[model samples]
Target: MSFIARTSLALSAPNRIVETAGRSLAYRRFGTGPDLVLCVRLRGTMDSWDPLFLDVLARHFTVTVFDYSGLGLSTGTASYGKREMARDVDDLVSALGLTRVIIGGWSLGGFAAQTFAALHPHKVSHVLAIGTMPPGPMLKPPEPLFLETATKLSNTVADEYILFFEPDSAASRALGDASMARIAARTEPRDHPTPPEVFLRSLQASIEPSGPFPDPDDAYARFYRNTDIPVLALSGDHDIMFPVENWYALNDLWPTLFVVTLPDSGHGPQHQYPEMSAEIIASFVRHTAAR
Candidate 1:
């Protein structure tokens, strides 16, 4: 099957690093316009993102993706906690001298993005969360299937389909295959995968009854409630991990928050609908900035 040819730019972007707080942080930058920094998800490195999605975003913004400290090729202490990971984002932003940026993430990275925007609101121009939940109790806890597939030492394309695509939709599965092919097409040097022990630690932390944000006064919740900065929670209608309904439930409480739901999709809407996802994000940044 033939795939779109636009993924080449993201596939060919070179790996680079910056010194931050005495540690070297691994990253890649491509595209143009304002800075947009994306944090990777649990068990993910910069290499895990779909090239088609990244390339499309590159057309609108100077996209940056990176590895958390001590994970992948970066050197430093690593912790899966959202607050700790937010520090990584902060250090990277400061190290790059980016005065302002659009902060985005997927899954666990979404948790980090939320925390970073809350902790350092001045640095983030907007918040874009893909296939992730907001802080506090979720409308639906993660399904067992996600854990069964996600914790594998290495995932096959089938496992990826289960973890990211809608199992009940044939079209979504076909798109998932195409996205996997686009990711595999990259021949450039890539970041190392997160170790099993590290990812297991994250899984354990997430499954605890308290969840990612145990505090009653979660920073993300408070930030969403009051901040003037626009927050876009992008998700699939049937996500098994972080359900999109959770975001919809809080739409009235957050002042500058919006939700975008894609039907017949699951956890990775950006991968299944790369061009549409990028356009939604670019439009969000553009229209919201005008307000």
Candidate 2:
């Protein structure tokens, strides 16, 4: 199917429920090829993704998107820690009877993806982490201005622009506007907004110190280092929240890691540069699967 057609199908796709771990989870699957499951970012639902971006990805791989427990249409209390979040994803995978899947996680989803690969290495074939930092002491906190803008319950278009795109780039701002338009297009049976308390818990879990890793500084190192699984990490050059430097440091730790930085973009590089992002991810998945 064409990109536009696939995107429309995704937006209008009926909700599918699967019972896993004593919880009813909502999920949607699109396209065909190697299995590629996407873990949503903080405060995001299954429908929060940009249609164009998702379409671009769906064109190349079979993509699965789902909500965290207690968020969106899923049932059960949400967990804050990435390990627990990873477990939720693993359950979803098992519920769907998928194996040897490629996982693409954005922002907080990236953390969960890493944790999942670490905890269940046999199920994962490749890891693609976007606009995320490795769990370690060297990670920098989000900027005060960015944090203040993002924490607002009702963020204006300007606030969202600042939070997702580079402030000084008009082109980037235009892409952000287009992304918002696509996200807003899913009108029927739209997902419920994540509760404030749940969002706060997830954010706190994302920033808090790790509880499962033996060494916080080497949390991800133990998982990806010397592993055959191809890891592709990408970020926006102007990401104020996690910053591209964090990803750079992560690549430094694993020399074999494939890393890319999208120019003139911020936290949501996939939204800002969907075609390039999808192309890179598709290439990485195909290359890794061929091995």
Candidate 3:
């Protein structure tokens, strides 16, 4: 591997910007091989990702993580709606001159990833989602605990455990601690956190049903069924926000969907097991790539 690709620069990679769609998007690009553009979760900035996870992904693909408009270090209006967010990803991809790339995200960002693929299928090679819900109504609703912990102005380690990792598991809690430490170890200038007010507005927007982002004629389940693009949804055994059961319910409906549930994991499977998660993602992309 080359120096830029081999060296884990997730902690120190210079932040870059590109003018797109009347906004200046702040992003970090690292790794090698295929392009992997990962969107951030709700109330998350570019700094929210675990450094170890990015480092592991860097080994196999050129990864790009960015801040959504009006959040973190980016400029312009921000909308929590997935279609609107997908527009940001599309603009960034065009500005970067990337032809086809794997679009991925965590939590709310996952919604944007799926929408982006549905909207601009020609520009996407694969859809990689983590800790996100399936389309249509869920078999089970999100736990109340998620909203209580997620909307906090600032989260403590304990709050993180509850929100991301399996709080009751000793092993998961330890992994969560390590992941948080790795994230904190990035001493370079980082993006700012999503403000409490902005995030609160986002929370409301997410709850208010805004319909499908795919096609006007296609509903939520129909979009997944018709889309031919390969999708990999990585989740935990217990996700307080968007449970794995919801995806399982529609397992046979999504033709190219691959779902993996990590044992003793929670919302942040990537954080709990960064190396394993990255390998799973890399393998998925390599195995699903076009011939």
| Candidate 1 weakest ten by summed lDDT | 1-10
Give per-residue CA lDDT, model 1, range 1-291, as digits (tens): 234433367777888899878888999999999899999888899888998888889989999999998889898877778887899999999998899999999998998999999999889899999999898876678899997888888888788888999977889989998888887776658778788988787567645467776657576687678889998999998889898988988889987888999999999999999999999999999999513
Query: Per-residue lDDT for 187 in model 3?
Result: 62
TM-scores vs. true structure, each candidate = 0.94, 0.91, 0.93
lDDT of all the models against the reference? 0.87, 0.80, 0.86
For candidate 2, what is the lDDT? 0.80
Candidate 2 lDDT trough over 10 residues, lowest sum: 208-217
Q: Write the per-residue lDDT of candidate 3 for residues 107-193, one digit (tens) a residue.
A: 999988988887888998899989997677666778999979988888899999999999999999999998887887766667888
Residue 223 displacement (Å), model 1: 2.0
Best candidate (score: TM-score)? 1
Global lDDT of model 3: 0.86
Of 1 and 3, the candidate ranking higher by TM-score: 1
Off by over 4 Å in 2: 1-7, 139-141, 205-219, 289-291
142-257: candidate 2 lDDT, tens digit per residue: 67788788777777899888988887889999999878877777867677788877787767765654432335456467657657778888899888877778667766666457
